[model samples]
Target: MRRLFPVTDQTSADRAATAPPSPGPDGDREWTFDELAEAYAYPPLAAGAVWLRGNMVATLDGAAQHGGRSQAISSAADMRIFGVLRALADVVVVGAETVRREGYRPARARAAFAQRRAAAGQAPAPAIAVLTASLDLDFSAPLFTSPLVPTLVLTGAAAPSERVRAASKAGAEVVIAGEGPGADPARAVSALAERGHRRLLTEGGPRLLGQFVAGGVLDELCLTVAPLLTAGHAQRIADGPELPVPARFEPVSLLTEGGFLFCRYARADAPWISRDQG
Candidate 1:
């Protein structure tokens, strides 16, 4: 990895003189752990609703899956960024289908982010908030029972009473965000922000990402472009009805490691316009 993005002696001295000193191995050459952390750090939260961001991985050919899951198209560098995003978030929002298909679990505290999280006044670990309309999640799963914070079930007010009751009885906080079929992404974001969760990250399973896109509430997206090409039939990262008009996003940052590209894009109208705006 060091050789992939090497820094010569002169370049190292130049960077050291210009950039603030960052702590990590091979800080002069490749992207060290600390370098990556600094590169992907989220901006400070404002007094209003939370800033929602989505994280996802896709193949070189735009396939979001290969063997019925995204794991087949992921890499170590991708996972490293994944953990960093979770560490920086105050809560993780996921779709229930993703939880069921991926066998989701609670977000455990990472040793690397202990000091960073504490310094930012964040909880020991971010909470997992699942979006479900049928309320079909497994309440007895460790995700609900063993999280540092109780799992939150975001569902529509019209969800089945029995399922909601079961979720609550199993130690999950059932939050009703909408009255229709599924939880409205806008309402869900507001509900989370109301609870003082200002830094939000959503690991979408495509369909839920579509809802967030449709809702116009997604502030930014950190997409990992995997190196492999999956020719198999698979959905795109965001799957839903076509947009009325193309949504624009301002590219914020782009980083690469071993052919995998990590790209962050913010909504066109978002306050944090760009890195230059920051």
Candidate 2:
């Protein structure tokens, strides 16, 4: 992968004009996992602060998925970045439907990130937080019974008691995030933050991501643009209630590999930005 924005040459030149001519853009050189990790690290946060980020991939025509799964539109490089993002997060917040459709499982402890996670006071593996209203999930699934860290079930206070009991019996923690039948997006973030999971990453199924966007809790977006195109009726990266005024975001970084463009964008009001851009 090669960086496509905030070129290193310009920034290095400005830092020390007398220094040996910096190797121009990292053209043609594949990026190491270490480099990718650094490029996508979460921004520093104050005490009790949360930084919610969404990671999704789409086709050139804006199809978030094909044939009911996102893996169809994703590439190897995108998967690499996906692993890295999971490695860096304290918890992965996802919609229940996404967990079901994608055959979601527990987040594993990656050897590459073990040291960094330990240094940050994080658990061995990031927990999977599934948002559901009815709590109609397979309690027998391994996601609940066998995660390195117990999986979390985010639901409403009015959720069915039996299902909540079932989730608890299966070893998943059920968090009440709303008063009604649905989990309120903002409440969900606060709930996770209260658990010391301040670095949040959501692998959206579009609907849940739309809710986060609508709730105005999403701080950043890491979008991978695939070169392929499928004209079918596929969801956009975020699909939900329309905003009164469209939210604006600034590009933080851009990387490309094998015809896929990986882009990171921070909320316009967020302090995060590319070093050179800052």
Candidate 3:
């Protein structure tokens, strides 16, 4: 609801020094959804280029989920931002496990984004791209049969023939993204890009995000830090094989509302050193 970083003249040091602490940077007035959309707009890219962003929420204690669901740790403001991200993206990528756990459904076209999407030449609703090696999914579900756009299944070349056939039979397009029995994060991005989906957003369930991180293909991260602290054995926002070196990211923007901190981080320009180099 309030812009906390990249302070503008309205929230400059001089103004803050002379004025009392206000609810938002612009006094009692909160930011509108249009303002938030502008603030979070994707950077311009050359034709055929792709930018992948990961949006996630975690507790103060670093729990990505509570009781196997992220909604438990999410707030209304977070959900609003989630909708905005989905509206802006060309495709929504997710791991199959997340689809099953979250009871995935087709993305409905939002009236608010219809005009913008039309102007940008995007689909009325972003397509859902599921990454699964086994192709173990409910192909008969609405996510595959009723999507405004056809759902995409990203798998490996070595995936089971029967499952891939089933997915194709149910109206879902199967894309081979790896040589092994799993989807390679970088290849998946390229596959989508080839299909004209340059603005990609991934709503991860940890492992999928980890693959993106490990592949060094994630361009930006929009993370919401919940105010509450849940002390339990829970996965972090990313989980996978340890990296040779921790990849650095620079904070691009920060916002807050009702004790929740929304942080945006972009991949740092510096090159990362691998284990052999180190």
Q: Pick the candidate with the highest lDDT.
A: 2
| 1-278: candidate 3 lDDT, tens digit per residue | 77776566554454333321223334224566566677677766665778899999999999999999999999988999899889989999999999999999988899988998898899999999999999999998999988999999999999999999999999999999999988899999999999999989999979999999999999899999999899999999999878999999877677888899989887786221211110
In model 1, the Cα lDDT at residue 93 comes to 97
TM-score ranking from best candidate downward: 2, 3, 1
Model 1, 22-121: lDDT tens digits are 2334422455555677766676444565788899999989998888898888888788888888998899999998999999999999888899889888
Clashing pairs in 3: none
**Model 1 misplaced regions, further than 4 Å:** 1-30, 273-278
Off by over 4 Å in 3: 10-30, 270-278
Give the local distance difference test score of model 2: 0.87
Candidate 3 matches the true fold with a TM-score of 0.90
How much does candidate 1 score in TM-score?
A: 0.87
- lDDT per residue, candidate 2, 1-278, as tens digits? 78776567566545232221222437756666677777887876766789999999999999999999999989889999999899989999999899889989999988888888898899989999999998888889989988999999999999999999999999999999999987999999999999999999999989999999999999999999999989999999999999999999987778889999999888887753332210
Q: Model 2: how far is 42 from its true place, Å?
A: 0.5
Instruction: Please report how far candidate 3 places residue 118 from its true position, in Å.
Output: 1.0
Runs of candidate 2 with Cα error greater than 4 angstroms are 12-25, 273-278
Clashing pairs in 2: none
